[model samples]
Target chain A: MADFFQSLLGNVTNVTWQMAVMWAIGALLIYLAIKKDMEPSLLLPMGFGAILVNLPVGSEALAPIKTLFDAGIENELFPLLLFIGIGAMCDFGPLLNDPKLMLFGAAAQFGIFFTLSMASVFGFSLRDAASIAVIGAADGPTSIVVAQQLRSGYLGAIMVAAYSYMALVPIVQPPVIRLLTTKKERLIRMPYEQKNVSKTTRILFPIIVTMVVGIIAPGAVALIGFLMFGNLLRECGVLDSLSETAQKVLANLITLFLGLTIAWRMQAAAFLSPQTLLILLLGLIAFVFDTAGGVIFAKAINLFAKKKINPMIGACGISAFPMSSRVVHKMGLKEDPQNFLLMHTVGVNVSGQIASVIAGGLILSFFAGLV
Target chain B: MKKKIFAVLAALLILLTPLCALADNPDAVETCPPMVQSQLEAAEGSITENAEIPEAPEAAEPVSEEEGASETSPAKGDQALSFGESLGYMLKGMAGIFLVTAIIILAVVLLEKIGGKKKDGQA
Candidate 1:
């Protein structure tokens, strides 16, 4: 009886105060995910994974999550798989209808480059700085893929920042948009016009985009190709079952595994660094700058255009997708009850999604040779 | 024609601003010696190509094992960078993204023109 108790509780005796702290942090994340409903899909699993990995187990016991990390994250499978699901779920109809909004999407990626430089100024290496800057993409998967490609030391912090800031887009974007644009600019209304896009156009759009991005920025081919393939699955109509599977079942499963796998990097020593704090701070700055970039770009364009654009539409260009679009829509409504920017914002928002993938590939391309 | 020219010019200006910034900074990429730069590039390529399994926590005696492992991981190192170099990379990267964006915009504009012409022909 004594020997059995000793064997069972021996691992418990090895638990450090830091492990206890990590458990608390994990519990907090779980609480935020469940009670606060903050990015529940990822936060819940990540919280559980953090606790599971940090628990005191005997030296001989196998760490299962580590295996998941190796299989999923280390080889860059999960993010790419998740992109397929994302592409399947995305409807590019709004963007297709209004092709010009793609400019805003491109403009918003200013945050990633700006943040990269800023992170470097803060004393990060080129690789780590670039990875951290990708948090500004307002994209979780892109951040993960870029950071993994760069082999950044702060992967856990970067992932945490990317997802957290995405969830916080509603809160982060509004003040920045308000600060940049006047009440009149925010209230500027562009009439909603629906232009029918041909089925052939829809089919060709993804293929053309994949080819264009692949040729120009070959490094981004994998990221863009997977995404376009998923979109192809959706638009082709014959692959309805496969599209649905990719959208629902595949996305959910991969997200769960991806969340849990990422926790392998969240061990107390890995996560509790001063650099983690800096990363979180820099991530917030990136979000702010991305919003500013879009808003400012819109304001700049408005100067030359005969038709005034609701400058707030620019704020939706970050890769937060429907969330940023929805936030801009709500802001438009608040500025003027009759203002409808939903489709317009969504258009730019989707563009941001594509632009972000392209930006990620571009970063890898430029930095691949430099690093 | 003028509007199209203006739009294209604006896009080019947006794309070129970063490259101009890179050119302004003389010491940015050139400061790093060629051999070290190549090695860094190689290391980066290999790291991305090979997915080495990260160290996991020991089931038992977790604290001591982790403490030792944590000391050796790259995350703990302090990487210092001067502001100029950071700005250089930032400009270069931003230029690359903007250039791609400019090309995409031109493609979309062409598509729109083609689509409009098709509609006119149909009418």
Candidate 2:
């Protein structure tokens, strides 16, 4: 009986403030993911990862799980392979249907460049600054790639900021959407016309994007090429089984590893640092500035147009998917019930998927050369 | 080649100019040489440096294979260039990515405009 008590006390010796903080963080992730339904797959695994990594140095509980993260995530291969599933699952139909939405994609990226400079001024190096800026793109893959390439000291903080902001798109973007546009502007209803992209165009797109973006941003080929390849499988019609696996099983598997591995980087010595707090602060700023850039750009374009585009949808350009679009849609409903920007906003949101990858390539090329 | 270089410069202009202008003491900043490789290495430990610039194979070929993968890969590393000058090369690498995007976006916009105009004319 005494031996059992002593062993339990020995186990409890590992409990430091750092461990407590990490446990709190893990619990927070669980609350947010489960109760709030924010990026459930990502947050749930991340919570589990945090628990496993911080489990008071116990035996038989965490060895294999930690090993899984250590082997794949540290090598940077997991995130890259995850791209194949992300690529394949993406339905470029909305984007291709309204190719003009690609401008919004470019518009969304303004935050990345904007945040890069701001982060630099805040005392981060160019590479860390660049990685932080990618959070504005609201793309987990792009953020992971940029952070991985830069090997930012605050990788955990940056990852958390990127993923959390993505899940909070509905909350974060709505305020910005409301601030940027007037109720009158939100009332601008767009006519929805779904264009049927031909089989040839669908089949050729991934190939063309892979070649074009790959040659230009060779650093991004691993990510964009796989993404486009996934789309290729999706559109090929003959590869339905492959596409299904890419979208469901492969993506699900990779997402788990990615989330947990990121949590492993959340060790106390790293997590409690001031730099992490700064990274999170900069990340939020990126999202805000991105929304501002997209809105201002659209409003400027609308000045030239006889029929103005709904400026609220421009916020959706930041690629939070249904969340960003929903924010725009909700704002629109507030202004006028008949006004619906869901499809248009979704169009731009999808374009953001492509744009963030392009931005990642651009940043990689720039700083990789600098280093 | 010249046009391509100019285009890279143009893209860099769009991305970097705003921040450069925001630096309060431009003259003071201009006076300093670029953040050299050594300084960056020193800072990496003290403040966590992120200066590693992955070099493209073609440009990186002249360096020893070790440095081809790491820092000191740029040709003018031994020389003291200005901040903008060193950053210019890094921006070029980044420009390589944006250049493709800009060209694609511009092309699609142009085509859409032309097609819309033609439709209006027919109407």
Candidate 3:
């Protein structure tokens, strides 16, 4: 009875205030996921895993989670594999119809570089700064790959910031978009023009993109290759079942494991630092800059173009996918219900996905050697 | 137009492949000079010894190449660049992305033309 009491009660005594704080943070994430419906697929698992790892249990008890981390995230397997599913789900026809929209994707990545400089100024090591700056990609997988490849110490904070900001795209982008654009610009309408894209073109796109990006930024080959490969599987016309499996089953399974495995690093000692707070702040800055960069680029293009483009479409250039696109579309609707910007914003949104991966690649190329 | 674009792409690929290979070649990696390397090793040894001897008087040695290198070394991953260097990276990165995007756009245009022809033939 004494031994039983010690075994049960002793561990309770070992729990520290930091662990208690982490529990609250975990509970808050769970509440946000359940009640607010913000990235529940990832946030829910991450919240539960946070509590699991932070328990006052011995390291031996948490060994399985660590093993999952080592096998999946540490080896860069999960994110790359997840990219295939993401690629399969994407329909690049919108982007293909208007390839100029791709430039907006490139422009939106300005936030990433801007945040890189800012994080360096704030005294983060170059690897950590680069990893942190990638949150501006508004891309979770890109963030994971960059953070893991760079071996940054703040992987947990970076992952949390990346995914949380991605989910908060609706909240983060509108204010920045409004600040950057006028009501006139916001109301400017872009009529969607659908082009009949050929099957051959659709099939060729992923292959060409992989080759081009691979040649330019070899460091990102794994990311772009897996992504484009999945796209190829989707567009090939014969692999419908495989594509469906990748889009649904494979993606969900990996996301589940990736979410839970990420919590291995969310222990109080690693995550409850001043730097984590700074990382969150920096992530917000990156998102804001990305929005501003795209809007400003559109405004700049309007100076030369014959037709005025709705600058709000530019805000969709962040890689938060349908969320960023939807935010811009809803904002357009609010400005003028007749102004339907969904198609235009979706084009820019998909292009942002490609551009974000390239941005991740460029960061890897530039810093892989320096670091 | 198709032939010219293909020729250009082929030429670009041929020109760029060797550069990529060179970049990835680990043998091309530069190392610190032997003298600097020896000094760094010695400095690291002294620092480790100092860490072990908590009671020892703190040394007032000037910051050496070892310390500077530590800030920028691959092993440390804590390289903090000056604002100017970071800006240089920004410019270079943006330029690289735009260049690649332009190339991709060119290729897409070429592919579109080819695909249009195929569709027309099928129709």
User: Using DockQ as the measure, which candidate wins?
Assistant: 3
Better of 1 and 3 by lDDT: 3
**In terms of TM-score, which candidate is strongest?**
3
Model 3 CAPRI rating? acceptable
lDDT (tens digit, per residue) of candidate 1 on B10-89: 76866454342333232322455788446533643332121111111122245546677653334311343456545545
Q: Which ten residues in a row have the lowest lDDT in candidate 1 chain B?
A: B48-57
TM-score of 2: 0.77
The positional error of residue A246 in candidate 1, measured at the CA in angstroms, is 1.2
Cα misplacement distance, residue B11 of candidate 2 (Å): 13
What tens digits encode model 3's per-residue C-alpha lDDT throughout B1-123?
Answer: 446645655664554333333233322212546774455336433322222221211321224343754432233355565565576566555655666666787778878888888888989
lDDT of 1 by residue, A249-345 (tens): 9999999899888988888878988899899999999999988989999999999988899989998889898899999999999888999999999
* Greater-TM-score candidate between 1 and 2: 1
Q: Write the per-residue lDDT of candidate 2 for residues A1-371, one digit (tens) a residue.
A: 99999976877877888889888988899899999998988888787777668767764676676686667665667877788887787777777677667667767777777677667667676566777778877888778777877666677888888889888777777788778888778778888887545566667767777877776667678888878888899999999999999989998888877888788777776788888888888888888877886787789879976768988777777877667877878888778888877788888887777777877777776555444
